[model samples]
Target: MFILTLSETECRKMLADNRLARLACAKGKQPYVVPIYYAYAGDHLYAFSLPGRKIEWMRENPLVSVLVEECGHGEEWRSVIVDGRFEELPDRIGHKRERDRAWSLLSRHADWWEPGDLKPVTPPLSKYEPEVFFRISIDRLSGRAAKAA
Candidate 1:
């Protein structure tokens, strides 16, 4: 068989249907990727996380990428990559509406607030505090798929 590039519609559908992805961020010459759960709505991806390396990196450098994939049978697979900018939703004036919208989109999942909400095992993270909501404004997205002939 052969691989084919997925259209924008297909890529958006995949993103809307999947909640898990690898969130990639970088600072200077270093890069980092971590599993994350997100909600796709309009032109942004909403997600939550504790403050740490990933958060700090993104804060310093908003440029980020997200990779979502599905691998089924031996010869079937689909994956999508999104390049975008990250923006944190703070609980303050002027940003209330967007923050609420982000929350609404992510609340659809039963366990939407997870690992983010889980307490640190070894040491209660000092970085975890207040509300942590953010969105990734999609700049470019692409996908590919393959199936056995």
Candidate 2:
């Protein structure tokens, strides 16, 4: 098998073609990673999530990373990594345009709402808070692919 580096275009294409990814954040050297769904548009990746540990950590430290991967049979696979800055899309003034864009982008996918908006249904809870919107402004994107010779 052989491994090759992917160009910026290829990396962006991989990110665009995939929706599920792993987002990594850190708080005082303790790194946390979780699977997330995102929409890639322009130079940013948009997502939805509730206020939680990851949100808190990202708020404290805007630097973050996202990983997207594709796997094929027989040792054929590829992965893309994005190092970016996380920024929340508040509903308040001065961010309406961005918020709208994020919504538009996220709405493009049918499974977009599954990641962060899911609520427990087994016990039947009455109160479940809505998810907030955020985006990662990509600073760098890299990718690698392996194919059997």
Candidate 3:
């Protein structure tokens, strides 16, 4: 399939429609990639993680990369790649708010939080304070789209 560069408007549209992305982080010698739920607001992307692998990695190395992609039959596809530096928000209240916002976007695109699903809703900050909530201020963003021939 041939690739076509996407306009900023087109990239944002796809970003709004999809919430799951692959996040890449490196710590000196090792690199890690993980699936994460994210929300795009203005020029920043936000995500929340419990005290786990991703959080540990990010703490050690704040530089990260992310990829969001959509593919269909034939050559129909779109993808966006982002490179940025991550910042862990220090305010608990603001972190919780941003986490909820990110989860809302994820719920819209994926079944991670179906209305009647047996899964527990993400607890509010008052209940289960996330270990960390971070924002990635994008330094570079590139997107491509390809239509079926």
What TM-score would each prediction reach against the true structure?
0.93, 0.92, 0.73
The digit string of per-residue lDDT tens for model 1 on 35-61 reads 888999989999988667788999999
Best-first order by TM-score: 1, 2, 3
Using TM-score as the measure, the top candidate is: 1
lDDT of 2 by residue, 99-147 (tens): 9999999998787777687654587556776568999999999999999
Model 1 collision count: 0
Task: List where candidate 2 sits over 4 angstroms from the true fold.
Answer: 119-130
lDDT of 3 by residue, 11-85 (tens): 777777777889999888888987877778878887766656667788888899999999877769889988998
RMSD after Cα superposition, model 3: 5.6
Q: Count backbone clashes in candidate 3.
A: 0
Q: List the residue pairs that clash in candidate 3.
A: none
Q: On a 0 to 1 TM-score scale, where does candidate 2 land against the true structure?
A: 0.92
